[model samples]
Target: MQSLNEILLQKKIKEIRFKAIASIVCGFLSIIPYLGVLFALASWILFFIVLYDLKIYGGTKNLFKNLFIVAGIGFFGILINVSVLFVILKPRIDIFGGLYFNEDNAFLAIGTFCVLFYITLALIFPFFKAFYYEIARVTKQKYFINAFWAYFIGICTLPLFGLGAIGVLIGYILKLVAWIKFKEFDEQEIVNLEERLAKEQKKVFDLKWIKITMASFIILNLLVLVFIIFQYFISFVGLDYNAELYIRRTLFYIATILALLSVFLFCKKLKTYKLFIYFLIWQGLSVFCDYILFTPPSIIMSKTAYGSLIIVLNLCCIILAFLFFKSLVQITKEKLFYLVFIFFTCNGFVAICYTSLLITLNHLVFEKLFLVGIILFQVAYFISFLIFWLKLKGQKSVKIC
Candidate 1:
């Protein structure tokens, strides 16, 4: 019979294999049109599982704990900034007429928000550096350093078109190299490292529950996709406004409910990261606000009130997308760069444009622009997915070992 240490070592090896396979799969699936998001979400769960396993069995608790602390602080800073903005802008919000900020007030608010945003960035940078530095140290490779610099440069040159893309591509390449090296670490060293973990007993997670939850999530996503298709078809057919609104609202509400349930289940099972929960909260609120807006009599709210609610929801969605991307980067780093680009260009831009549309609903030009934006967004996502699938299919899978 195998000794306890041997059993543990085998388990760790299996997990490493799983993580490598998952990363590869995620990279491949990220190119698929609408389904890429669902696959990415699943990959996030797998990444979290790998992290948890590493924390418990690989003696990397401090590294993960510190990373989580930094992430939490960053999230908190964003919340604080948002709260402050709300406070500053509340008086300027004319419930009946919408935002009425004068030129001076608008400038002041923008300046203040920018200052706070920079401060938050400054505070978060060191933590990220430390995290990357540790990964490099563990892997005994300088690729992570390359990734760090590349990503930093990318962020700095974000205003430039081609420059940012180049930086991102370089960063992603380095990150992939680092991850591959980390996965190929000496087995004896891993066994030695796990010795320290033996002293601390950890609870075993039920694999069955995880499978069930994931299955449910997949089903919910499919339902959502169906609803989206039907709704789009209705729009294309030029249905009556009342009929279209009713169909859209009903399908949207149902889809939202299913999405919320799936997210809740995943959170309950994982219980580690709060990013998913934060997203769920914002999503639910957004749907609720939409409900209010679409309901008859306008729920006794003025146009300004409805618009503000939509704006808030869109802001929350933007934050949610940022968190999602951050979480993916934490796991895949450079390997996620291309998908990250697609997400920002498609979903992220959609959110921003939608928010702008909500803010200027009265403007015919803005309304027309939004319609065009939506079509472009869909096309971009589809093209990205096709590219990913083609590239992945063309490549041969290399053994991790």
Candidate 2:
């Protein structure tokens, strides 16, 4: 006969395992269309249940409190989304189309809808911050603070784009890690976890190739920024359209090739980094998509096919970023490392958006907006990278036992 405490420990372990499995399943299901929503909702329900159980089973009260906060904010976000969708769709439906509203009433409704939309958008980071912080506490890893900031910035910049997807993906992976760590704690196997973590951190920190790879990544980004600035400057100076187009095309091909090479080099040195491999695959696919886009219409696929492929590639990039950030947090205990990665992720999305708008939108207003947006984003990215670079340069390798 097992003691009461032993029985409770076993039950807690089982619950943790179930949560881990469900998190992974939800991650995969989130990439699916339509069905993804159902799975996401189910995951939230499970999360609440797990948090409640943790509270009841001698787990930290802060975990429950933080998670409840996240749930409340997330629920409000969902409500805002639903309400906005209803407002937009109502005018399209036949029943509602027949309904008439005066100018004042219509303006009021639109203004209210816009306000709600922005409010929901603003809540994205807070929700991620609360969720990640709670997971970090459960895992007992101080480095998850890095993950929390990475995800917060990633989602806040582009809530519906690849950046937000990456944040969510990373959060799911961290959730799985938390479950695993909790299970180990339940089994009393975590006594040496700190020692092991220190060893792993030192080993990773002492790797010269990783330092070199990181430097190359920073240089590549700088080069991309330079080319982007040059490309836009020429346009503003009233250069020939063909000249601008050629420069833009060259920038794209060069950046894509260099980025792919960097990934390959990093993988060659750090084969254990599976997340980097996933990111490599994503960049490769994106390069292929770019190539297809530039190909002649006769040789290229249909518009619908191209659009679908882009969507899928964007989703892949999100998952890759998520995994990459999670892996970085696991290996390097530096909070600044996460911040640097967040800037890189944001820059990537901004570049992609700029390219997309340049190709698809011919309106003068949109072009001006793209130019301004890119400039602002580039400036911010440069500052972040500069700070990160200085920090990296000053960092000394930790000695491993």
Candidate 3:
């Protein structure tokens, strides 16, 4: 009979294969109207995770971090592309600075739009190149380049109308094919590392409670965010604005409190869970200390003065936090990367925003904007954070590999 390790390894291999196929399905789903961005986001994240999982099979180092270029740059491309899709659908819609193209000026508008769009595509091509090029380099899937070229050619021929459309379709097909072709991995390598791999699996297994608690916390947090966002649409006509605001704020606070409680049963033995706790504590302390000690209204004489103070405070807190990150805790680079890139960077932006805004007793916009920023940041971080746990959830039971 096969040993338990052998059986578990078999399951893991099968899971890796399943996830690759699932990623393709998600990519396909990304074409669906209305929900396309959601599906595409899921696809991008899932592909990142699949490569991370393939680490065991391919033994490729820094597989996820190598794509930092893609993630960092691709993020902007996402906004640009989403804007393009909007323009394509609503060609005459007002864009930046009261600018728009209208059917009334069909010929000129069409020509101008085509040129601008080609320019847009031109900007996007580098992102596409980096995306496929890095994947090809890491996964050794040379055909990925063919997909990139197909997309490039498609964009180049886009001004050609009909022919360009075919090129784009071909590119997508090749992309899907490339994604589906990841079934082969070095099975022998996995067999060689069986013992150590088993240990890794066990470490992952011990993290199950953490995974569940975090998942609950994230879901509840998102629900609260959505609830708050919907309040922006409420028609408070003939209603007491103060009462409505009170109700909205009360519900939000309650939801947040419940989200915190859902994760209270967490195991303290795993230092991993403390990672988020410490980061949050760092945020709270930094905000309180910086706002209190440094920025008294007497010192905030000029706009420049206020802005300068806020920037210095944020940077100092960040540098101090980095020191704590280095000395007070043991954490992985990837985890540290998330803490800095997502949480700390976001907090810095929020702090700077608050300082720049002119706040008065009656001006609630600043407070609302801050709340929105906080929720948006949580949404961004939790998406990736949830994926981290899911990746670990696959880990079966042992000691550190």
Q: Rate the local accuracy (lDDT) of all candidates.
A: 0.57, 0.55, 0.56
Question: Weakest 10 consecutive residues, lDDT, candidate 3?
Answer: 262-271
lDDT of candidate 2 over 305-365, digit per residue (tens): 6545555565566567667656655644446656655654665566567555544654445
Q: Which rank order by TM-score, best down to worst?
A: 1, 3, 2
The best-first sequence of candidates by lDDT reads 1, 3, 2
Off by over 4 Å in 3: 1-14, 30-45, 62-66, 77-141, 159-165, 179-183, 186-235, 238-401
Instruction: Give the worst 10-residue stretch by lDDT in candidate 1.
Output: 392-401
Regions more than 4 Å wrong, model 2:
1-213, 232-271, 296-299, 340-364, 378-401
Q: Which candidate number would show the highest lDDT if scored against the true structure? A: 1
Q: Which candidate model has the greater lDDT, 2 or 3?
A: 3
Better of 1 and 2 by lDDT: 1
Q: What is the TM-score of each candidate against the true structure?
A: 0.45, 0.36, 0.40
* TM-score: model 1 vs. ground truth: 0.45
Residues 30-138, model 3: lDDT tens digits: 7765345444544664576567656654565555554565455556755665565556545553555474544455565456556666665666666667766755664
How displaced is residue 174 in candidate 2, in Å?
44
Q: For model 2, what is the alpha-carbon lDDT of residue 22?
A: 74
The parts of candidate 1 lying over 4 Å away from their true place are: 1-21, 24-34, 83-110, 156-169, 186-191, 194-401
